[model samples]
Target: MSVHTACPVTTRKTLGQVLVCLGCCCGRTDKGHPPVPVDWLKSEWKRRMLPKKIHLSISGCLGPCDASNVVLILYGQEAIFLGGLHEETHYLALADWATDCDHQGCLVPLPESLEPFRLERFVDEPVAAGAA
Candidate 1:
């Protein structure tokens, strides 16, 4: 039996991307982490027509397993890391943020509701004095 089926694939142009991590820790309610609202997110993304402006990908194991329920937003050259999104409101806020950015045709500041979820997983090294 053939397990795979062929399907048409089309490349989409998007202004940014949102990556939701459903890793071992994330989306595992049994492990004490909150459930990821995958269905709601997908519905919201489609309803808002975000596929044309923002690409949404539900991925697995985005690292930093310590921070469950992680979401990464890539806008331009910036990668924003958000963690501890354990609430339905957080997902709603994310949808809203993406919709606003799409409407404005550019990245916009994160709404207050999502401000608390912002996290810094990577840090840049400082340049040495007169090293160049």
Candidate 2:
């Protein structure tokens, strides 16, 4: 529903990050079928034992309906939006990337293969006052 100016988990140093926004625009069914199975995502994250700093949650909406099922890897003020995530391969890639970032204590470079899935350069919009 609203974009976050800053991540809820604010750390002084950059660490592994994954913002899985199963907003209103996403999940269950758009027209007929489901998108981005949320349960699978949660299970996979736990099974992988991803780093502690890896923040993942379902937000209201992140403003890109055309790019449904958005998953973001945040780094400081910048973020990488990966859209149309409906396959196991995509999740595996995400897990690998997160592990790498955790080890590096910073955002790891995304592979060229994943370049196509990238939605756009994400810049968090300022939150409106007295709207909470």
Best by TM-score: 1
Cα lDDT tens digits for candidate 1, 1-132? 564566477666587999999988999999999999999999989988997798999999888778789999997668988999988999999999899999999889999988888888875776788988
Instruction: Give the whole-model CA lDDT for all candidates, comma-separated.
Output: 0.88, 0.69
Error of 2 at 82 (Å): 1.8
Off by over 4 Å in 2: 1-14, 30-34, 121-132
Tell me the alpha-carbon RMSD of every candidate. Answer: 8.4, 6.5
Q: Alpha-carbon error at 45 in model 1, in Å?
A: 0.7
lDDT of 2: 0.69
**Pick by lDDT: which candidate is best?**
1
Worst 10 residues of 2 by lDDT: 25-34
Q: RMSD in Å for candidate 2, one decimal?
A: 6.5
